[model samples]
Target: MFRNIVVGLSGGVDSAVAALLLKRKGFNVTAVFLRNWDTADETGKCLADEDYKDAEYISKKINIPLVEVNFVKEYWHEVFTYLLESYEGGYTPNPDIMCNKNIKFKKFYNFARENLKADAIATGHYARSSFGPYLEDYKPGAKVKLLHAVNQKKDQTFFLSQVSQESLQRCMFPLGEMMKTDVKKLAVEAGLGVIAQKPESMGICFIGTRTFQNFIPQYLENKPGNFINYETGEVVGQHQGIHCWTLGQGCRIAGSSEKLFVLRKDIKTNDIFVVPGTDHPALFSRILITSKPHWICEEPESLIDSWTVLNCEYRFQRNEKLCPCRVYKSSNNKLIIVSEKEKRAISPGQFVVLYLNDECLGSAPITHAGPSLHSLGEGEITSDVDDNDGLLRASTV
Candidate 1:
């Protein structure tokens, strides 16, 4: 068993409980509070100061030493730069995913193992793995697969889809099988009721309380664009930037008998195509082409053979229901996914996380959504092909 364990306390009930559990399990626990953001609130006060104080309270009461580390430079290089590029490229990217991939799992993992000289690390994330929680059943140098938490309501595997294999093997999730209600109950029982009652934090970590539409303009110039109706190609209104809009959401434009929703965004033309209603046929996508996938483990054996079509489940949004899909090779050998049912608002730059029952297989960003149900006849629309290289018209889907 690992003697020295480092637990990341986020100043929430979740991480507090995680560290408490590790201490109770007879491990030497050290609490580390990471300061990843250097931003200030509207009042010009450091946004993370409160979180740090709460973390200190939890560590003090739990009788564990607390340490603070700043990763502002590492965070900017790994996560922030990617966010800027993805937004400038006209794709809405999720920074939280990048944070897990680069910060929590990679940077933080290395810090704990080398700097802290710890045998293992733990977090409050509601995720499990093929390697048991706390790694009681893991063998050295063996493979590990991230799995869905028993608490489906709080399952965070989608955010962890991009984590590396090494990180998965050494991390522990004490809350994997515990319910939120039970976790809070335990926190209260442990005399940490003040920590247990804190409201869950939300939004981009650095953005803090500011709306996305507002916070982004501070970093990137607001390039002007036009909202063109998909059916008529008539300019409805002007938008500050394509970065401000997302597919399948209400378009806040002026003077229309009906409200508009985004259908497609053309980065080169600086134009956004819109539909009349939220349920517009153009809003639904049945297929999407993706970049090469980043599998948490090795590529599934089912896909080891070239040109093999694999049946799997996928979710674009973290909380989205797992929808049935088929992943196969395209005529250009691109990774293509066709859904059993048309999905609404499938956007470019968003990742499609693949799954097999409970285990997270991997994820790939949607490079080109095949074509909305109602095609605009523009952009990189795709059609699937047979193994023999003949084009199979996926448009009829």
Candidate 2:
């Protein structure tokens, strides 16, 4: 059994219960509250102070030592800047994924080991990792296997795919095998009533309850652009900035009763193309080309050789159906994925995580996507423009 442990206390019922469980298991557990983002919302309110207070209260209730660490500078440099740059370059980047890779796992792991003298670090994330036989050598302790949580509704493997193997090997997920309902029950039983009833946070970590459009302009200079109809190449309306919209998002296009959806953005021309309907052919694609892939364990040859059939899930949410696909290698060492069924809104800058059964293999950042030859029609609009400017950076994994 692990002797010394440090758990990230996020001031939520999940982490509160996690701390309780670890203490009960006879481990010397310490709780650390990470102040990652210190920015204020549009209303000039900061949520980090409230969260820190809750974390402190929970630590006293659970009779454990609590420490506070500020990672605002690290978050701004490693995660927030990347997020703004990706939007400016016309791609929707996931900052949560970046936060997990750079701060929670990388920076926090180092702090736990060096300062706290911890043998293992844990979190309330709804994902599991365990020592298992190597994928290549079949040797014990050769690899750490990442698996979905038992509560499928709360799986977080997608956000954690980019975390380094060294961090995962010493990591513990105390709530991985339990359901959310049970976690709340345990929190209440342990006298953590305030945490058990707190609502879960949504949207960007720093933005809190503010509108995304209002918050983004603070960092990125808005470049107004023309909204063009994808079918006829006619100017339908004008947008304040391309950064305000993302592909597949519904927008109120001028002079159209039917809702319009963003199909593509041409950064070079400063134009955003829109289609009439949500089911437009231009919005769906079967082929997705991505940056270099990051495999959690060993690189699977099946992805390069043979047909390499696999199942993919773009969004990490529960109840999302997996899309069957085959992986191939492009000439430039990028991954070319062909889905058996047409996938709607295969947005660039989003992650495409691959899985075999329950084990998460790895993921890659999508760079380009288009309809398969069979799905392409004569009148359908397609963006031939190259959008690889922002994707040239190395994978953070």
Candidate 3:
């Protein structure tokens, strides 16, 4: 039903192939290059200039008009600000999720419809939709399910869990059924061989080559704190900032050789608790509490029913395998998730994406993970987890 399409062409292999595929399908395709990072502040040179030049060449080769738009200010306000606040508050936020929600789907979607008069905005993401790759069955008031891409290794649906249903109905993922290797092969066949040779971009773009510790300090204050051993409650070391460490991440002590991992962040006390070794029980959490969920299409019927709890599959990180879990609705719209298995380093501030097989139900930002093996007694594994400060039965809470 829709024809005019604006593809996010970043000169990368995936996007080049995406634009090529849509253009071959006889749709009017426009390549949009988004400049989100401003390198003038510190780098002195424009880091994204090379990327734009490649995009220009790719668009010309594909015979599509290329338009460059600057969303540097929008990205800072929408994605970067949230990242700083989450870190300062002792949470490991997923800015990639927010980038899709606020910038790519929201800002870019709007720009395409308003400026370019496109019927839909397409992305190079390895994800699919129940409405078809081109959103052929999309309707104004109907719900659309976000399905996983056939290539699970390159699946990006987790990053799009917070996407609104409206934007989803107007979006297309051209790489849904294509593998990374296949995408590169197609790019090479399209005479865009250089694009296929480009290295895949990872993590936050503005940080570039700098380590997390090095780049974060430039924006956040250096509030030093003590690193206490969770088991001994003894000050093991000091850190420049609690924001620098995340749950389950490694911690190094000056002059000490024992490897330690983060257990918890006491934001009020300004202390980060650590335990020696990656296999420490103190690093595993069996239960997690989350903020309100944002369902892309509609609330699952069972969730909306009077049923107090329902079983589902969930994962915090994209690479982590989904775990069977019981979901409970707590007071104030919070969700209590009892993971069937002990999850290592379930950090607060992470977005927990829920799935029912291949379809993404929704996602919620993690607020707390608790009842670590260190705190629970042996028999409490099942009973104690259900009675955790009365939070165990979130449906009643």
Choose the strongest candidate by lDDT.
Answer: 3
- Which residue pairs does candidate 2 place in steric collision? none
Q: Model 3: residues >4 Å from true position, as ranges?
A: 40-45, 305-307, 378-380, 386-390, 393-397
lDDT of each residue in 285-389, candidate 1, tens digit only? 677777778899888876766557889899999877889987876445456787888788888789999999899998988776755656633322344332224
Q: Lowest summed lDDT over 10 consecutive residues: which window, candidate 3?
A: 388-397
Task: Give per-residue CA lDDT, model 3, range 296-355, as digits (tens).
Answer: 878877667432776889999999888999887755777888888988998889999999
Give, for candidate 1, the lowest lDDT window spanning 10 residues.
387-396
Q: What is the TM-score of each candidate against the true structure?
A: 0.94, 0.90, 0.95
lDDT per model vs. reference: 0.84, 0.78, 0.86
Q: Order candidates by lDDT, high to low.
A: 3, 1, 2
| Candidate 1 residue pairs in clash (backbone atoms < 3 Å) | none
RMSD of every prediction: 3.1, 5.3, 2.2
Q: lDDT score, residue 77, model 3?
A: 94
